[model samples]
Target: MPGYKNPDLEYLDQQGNVVGYGEVKTVGDADQSAFNKQLAKAVKQLRVREDVEGKMDVNEIFIQVPDLVDAREVRGWFRSYQKGRLHHGSDLEKISGYHVRVYTGSGSKLADVDLGVDADGGHYDESTHTYYSSNGYSY
Candidate 1:
């Protein structure tokens, strides 16, 4: 919204008289680029939160360190992806904690699952093999 100002603050000349006419400008290329960058960052953060939350919602399943891989690492180096749709930060700034449960396989237990990473950039627990809850809030 455009702000309301005293008439003097608007079109006043050196003599404090209205010029009667002036130009109203639109956002320029630079402004658009800045907006885009900020938008991307926001999206990245949202995606990161969703991804972390999804994994944490999985039932309790404890696996060894050698079992699964960090999906983020496999994906790419993202300070935040797609502008911030996914924030690949040290901290998982989305989920509170995890609800883990194990499901046994018939013969082979493939360790190609999600290993939740906390905001501090640490694995939840190597032995428990479950995603950890945040400190009551996402950072």
Candidate 2:
């Protein structure tokens, strides 16, 4: 018609080919509730597929720890002197014993030593010098 002032909706196929007639887009007589319900269902399905079951766990992930380390030891013999340079034992044995290394912020490295949690579990260095012990830790 000659005095048409409305836009048309051009339908396209899967291959982007125009195959059908055009229809005008309007808010007239639209089932908005049904459209919203379908949209919510699609979103729910996508969320379910990307759930925690589809994600990898910590045990399934792989990480590498260097056996031979060259960092500054904060406890035993080697200690840190400079700022931003802090290190503890790389080997499991050094941190296994009762006498563990402690760093004091009073300009003293290995200024204090504390006992571990028995012969099995170990002590935890809460702060630089503050130490706590636990016997339930695996390593």
Candidate 3:
């Protein structure tokens, strides 16, 4: 703690209690080309939170992305990005927060293949998993 700077921001609960540390980062990319780089920098900016997490009532690291781009657009791009990651075996877990968004897309035809096995299945055995399409792929 002596040589490290703390996270730039503090997250507080409704009662004004410190809950965690993080940063409010903005992603200006309207396309996928810079999304990964922007995301990595945002996460790196939160590294200082490691100092107090789980030690001072700080249980998390947060990276809040401002809606510089329209929410719908950011979400659309993110969904497509996620699908791309899955298709290539990339991990999205490193990004902060639990995502409830579905990553998938419906095929042009009944037999058209997309994210998984013919737009009906994907990377793993998802026969029983509930899926919703987003950006033309299934997760």
Of 2 and 3, the candidate ahead on TM-score is 3
Judging by TM-score against the true structure, name the best candidate.
3
Winner on lDDT between 1 and 3 is 3
- How well does each candidate superpose onto the true structure, as a TM-score? 0.19, 0.18, 0.39
Number of backbone clashes in candidate 3: 9
- Give a tens-digit lDDT track for model 3, residues 25-134: 33344454565445444344444354445433432322233334333343344456556657778565543242222211221111111211122222322563323343
Across 6-125, the per-residue lDDT of candidate 2 in tens digits comes to 213334578876432222111112233332233223323322332423421111101111222111222222112111112322332322221222222232333222222232224535
Name the better of 1 and 2 by TM-score: 1
lDDT for each residue of candidate 1 in 31-89, tens digit (9 for 90 to 100): 33433343333333433443443332222222221223342321221223222434445
> What lDDT would each prediction earn against the true structure?
0.29, 0.26, 0.40
Against the hidden true structure, what lDDT does model 2 obtain?
0.26
Most lDDT-accurate candidate: 3
- Worst 10-residue stretch by lDDT in candidate 3? 107-116
Could you report the Cα RMSD, in angstroms, for every candidate shown?
21.3, 27.7, 10.9
After superposing candidate 1 on the true structure, give the runs of residues whose Cα lies further than 4 Å from its correct spot: 1-30, 55-139
Order of models, best lDDT first = 3, 1, 2
